[model samples]
Target: MNVDLNIIVFGSTGLMGTAFETVCRKRSISYVGMSHQDIEITSMEMVNNVIERYNPDTIINCVAVPSIDPCEKDPELPLALHCTAVLHLAKECAKRDILFVQPSTHAVFDGLKEEPYTEDDQVKATNIYSATKLLSERFVATYCKKYYIPRFPTLYGLRQNNSMGFVDKVITWIREGRDMKIADDKMDSPTYSIDAAEVVISLIVNNEPYGLYHVANNGCVSYYDFVIRIKELMNADNNIYRAKDSDFSSEIYKPLRTALQSVKLKPIRSYEDALLDYVNTDVIGVSD
Candidate 1:
């Protein structure tokens, strides 16, 4: 991919977007990152104004209400960002013939299947959050003919306020000398934020085909394994870990194994190694 290509990234303050911006800056790729302070995507007027001003070759919307409980509490908010804002952005992109990319999630599946879900797997969203994301995907498919959709799973990197990212949260708990509680039944292939950003940038710069594709780090593991891995990486005691799955439903109705396969795109590296790199980097929560 050419290094001089310009790209406009939304949700710039988010875990994925922040890592994307950092990668772009490190690579000297000409790009602009936008947060809510820059332009509110929910506002059609603001979306239009920003698009008109930048006229970027591509627009990537990373905005998403990831907290499942919050989404369940207020479905309207997720609908706004995931469905409404997506529709508006799709219309804008269609009108201008510019490439649009929407970063979707793995929650858009039901955990009924025993094997990994392919792109063709039937979607059975079990919660308001997943349903909203599915609605957004439908809208994007219908309106934006020239667009890319990279469905991501648990992207953990440089999350703002350290409020999100299961890995970061676990590290914070350890640093704070708190015991960790993890779900043993829940399963997913957590993607490193850097890997996700790199793949998305590759798709944009390479003018890759416009379609739904999964982008996640390789290797599947339970939440318990994820926690154990983090603790091990931090050189912390494993006894600090505890597991429970009975309350997962009350928190977020998630697919037990929405571990996606990115067979079409270049294969993602293993999460075991990726996690090590992530913890060692300054981007993620590192105790100084």
Candidate 2:
């Protein structure tokens, strides 16, 4: 891998963006990370200015809106952040022949099947949030010939700034003994942000073939049991109410089972192992 390979990471202040920055620095790869405040991806003028300033060979778009409960009622935010912003980056990267890295979620799957989902699985988005995400994937593929779209089941990173992610919040809540409705049936292949960043950035550094890769952890577990493990590992206890995916049918768009596997890339560690490592080292409270 070339250490001098120039890369630009959008959403640098977010979980996945921070992970990519870490990996790039550790590997001695050259890169620039941009937050939402640094650049407005929705505005093509800002995007064009940054492209000219950096003149990077690759652009990784990590901008996203985590909250999705009101996505159907209000598609404006989700559409702009996920679809329109992606459109701008995709078009620019395509025109400049720059490699485009788009990180996607497991929500793209319908979750009707119990088995692990692969990159080749037929994507059936049940709600507006997933629909816009799916639309972004199409935009990347349609516009950019050289692109890397890796679908992760769930990515858990540091809770330093943006502390709204489920895994970190659960860890904080358990330590603080705050109650949360834990879903016993909402299955997902939890992925560590560091591990994901390593795999994805390496692929880009090596300039691998452009296509979708299921870059998720090995096994899957429900949200309830996953939280239970966190408490056990931390030598703490909490009384989280047990619930099922159907309990929050409103989040049906999120899908209950989104276990993912990679047929195109090397398989990473298991979700259990990743969670343990996270709790032992990277875990922090929301207030931290």
Candidate 3:
């Protein structure tokens, strides 16, 4: 990739987008980060206007309706955000001969397999959110000639508020002295946003093969164990208990385990190490 290559990042205000922006800044990579307020993704006119103005070498789209409940409650909104808008962007990238990078989640799997899911594994979207994401992935693959789809698992990092990442919610609960219970039955690879961002930057700079890749932290753990690790790391005195997936009721279904393993690229770091870094950098100032 050329050093002078211009990149455009959509969904710039979200956690993953912010991480990508931070990485781009540190690497001295030129990019224009646009939030939803700057450009409505569901509108083709807005997307085309931005593309026409930037004429970037690459377009990294981080836009999506991530939550399961919201996607289930209103299906059309997520469809527009994740699938329809993505097709428009992919078509534009294809026309401009630009590389399109899309970040996806591990939720595309059904979690029936005991081992970690690979990029080639058949996707079984258990919920509306994952279904939309899977559809978006297909649209990008079908329309865009040059594209990179990196699937990730549970992600956490700095600048992430309570609603975005699970780690932030845990930290908030600890600070508020609220008793919490996390599901022990559900397992996943909790990836750090910074590490994930680094992988994306590496793929772009190295001009690696264009296909689906699984980018995640080194290992997997149940949600309950992850919270326990967080409590231990933060030294919080709050009562945190373990619960099974059956304990909770939701309108949308979630896979019990969606741990992702990357055969294409080496894993970055352990989830424990990543959590420590996040706590030291972002959560140390909060009162417990």
Give the number of the best model, judged by lDDT.
Answer: 3
Give the Å error, residue 191, model 1.
Answer: 0.9
TM-score for each prediction? 0.93, 0.94, 0.96
Instruction: Please give the lDDT score for candidate 3.
Output: 0.86
* Model 1 stretches astray by more than 4 angstroms: 1-4, 160-162, 248-252, 283-285
Clash list (residue pairs), candidate 3: none
Best by TM-score: 3
lDDT tens digits, residues 1-288, model 3?
A: 236668898988788888888888888889899987898988898888898898899999988886778888899988998988898888888998999998888989998888889887899989889998999899999998899999989888765333446777787888787899899989999988999999988998989999899999889899999988888878878887889887998756788889999889987888888888878777785542
Between prediction 2 and prediction 3, the one with superior lDDT is 3
- Candidate RMSDs in Å, in order, are 2.0, 2.0, 1.8
Q: Tell me model 1's lDDT, rounded to 2 decimals.
A: 0.81
Q: Is candidate 1 or candidate 3 better by lDDT?
A: 3
TM-score of 3: 0.96
